[model samples]
Target: MDLTGKVAIVTGSGQGLGLAYARELARRGAAVVVNDINADTANAAVAAITAEGGKAHAVTGAVGSTEVAQALVDGAVETFGRLDILVTNAGMLRDKVVWKMTDEDFDQVLNVHMRGTFTCVRAAAIRMREQGEGGRIICIGSPAGQRGNFGQTNYSGAKAGILGMVRTWAMELQRANITVNAVVPVAATAMTETVPFLKPYVEAMHNGEQLPSFARRELGFGGPEDAAGIVAFLAGDAAAEVTGQAVGVGGDRLALWSHPDMTTTAYHDGGWDAEAIEQEWPTTFADHLESVGEKLPEEASAQ
Candidate 1:
């Protein structure tokens, strides 16, 4: 895929997965706007790209607010002359079980992942529609979001909300040719490298030690750059019609996650009364109940 002459914006691009995405898009010839809360990392990301003969500019800001979102879109247009791609990769994590979680904890994650996604997407969609050209909006997702993870009430909720919006926006923006999709990536990034059980694996990867084959093949785990190519593909012409999809990618594996759909159906003329449903529930629904939680190999923590 090629992105020559395209101007793109990648939020939270100062480091980790976002940094990988920014570098990938720029490598494919897009003029990138690298956004992050930290000015140092943002500038450094820009430098890294430009040093490789790719075009990039830094826009430093946290992404949840409308003002910051607008500035990001504006940065792309004013700096590079047009906006064609947007990768909503900025996020923060506050892990705690539901009972131990605070209102601040819940809201912080929501504001960054879900609300930030909405506002940035709204801003980008408006600009893209105005330009009368199709654009790409790639929102990030997680296994936690798809299959509820332990101690990630806020994160799961926020990411699930992103995929939900992607589906809705896909339908809404179809006429404009703007493709909106979500990427569910599992990689060794800043957000995940700290997990107690995975710390060893993360450290090993960093030390250039080869991990077990299962880690990359089954767990779909690896460095952030391994998942970066999918972002570049989704942002290019080849994926113009590929919208509302939630694709998973990591080391040695790529997958397409199924959208939520009913796996079983039952009929009730008017509606079954509580007693009748209780009597039939086990036979009708119990056998079909889907299990939840991230499907991890026995070696990792549930989260």
Candidate 2:
């Protein structure tokens, strides 16, 4: 979809998936404000976009800062006259099992992915409301958040929190015509390369070796561009009605995620006492309990 004359801001866009989103938006005719903590990479992204006949400017700063967030929004309007889209894609990983994870690691991930998104969205929403043209706010989420990963408690918590914000903002901004959504992307970026299980294939790709067919079939479309298409679609006019969604994007696949809901419940006249609940526990909740990283009896043999 064409985004002609629309001005957009993408954070953490110095490289990887953020860069892909920025470049694609520019290619679709939107003037872009590329924000990154690294000045050199931000400048390079801007130069690349400009060289390809697209409009873009670099804003270098840590996205978690309120001042930086405000500057990004103001800079976009100052450079391009209006803000229409925001892609909060700035993030980092500090993977460690829960027992080993430091408070610093946890806070750092949350600061960038969670607080960074909040600050940027808060700033962009103000501008969009003032301009009287409702805008798109796209937050990048992760599969790790939806289904927990072994060593990513911090990252997963932050990403899952983003989806919560997306739903809340979508409802709050509906009257203003703004839509907020989350994209849970599985892409082979610097972040994904950190996973020990995926490291061999990532290195193989870098070395120009042909990937095993099964592996290729599963993850070949894990490139940033593959996921960028969905971001571009959500940012465009066609997706105005598609807010509050957590959409999965990966290798040749796009899927809608179910929102949290009460699946089942057990009730009694004037809630049961602890003794009564214990007596009925097996019949009320035991059989219906959700699995936590465990295989069902039917699938145990397959493993």
lDDT (CA) per prediction: 0.93, 0.87
Candidate 1 clashes between residue pairs 3 or more apart in a chain or in different chains: none
| The best candidate in terms of TM-score | 1
lDDT of 2: 0.87
Per-residue lDDT value at 153 in model 1: 98
**lDDT tens digits by residue: candidate 2, 122-173:** 9999999998889999999987777677788999899889988999999999
Which TM-score value belongs to model 1? 0.97
Ten-residue region with minimum lDDT total, candidate 1? 294-303
Once fitted onto the true fold, the runs of candidate 1 whose alpha carbons sit more than 4 angstroms away are 299-303
- Top candidate by lDDT: 1
Candidate 2: TM-score?
A: 0.91
In model 2, pairs of residues that clash are: none
Q: Model 1, range 46-76, lDDT digits (tens) per residue? A: 9999999999999999999999999999999
Question: How many residue pairs in model 2 have overlapping backbones?
Answer: 0
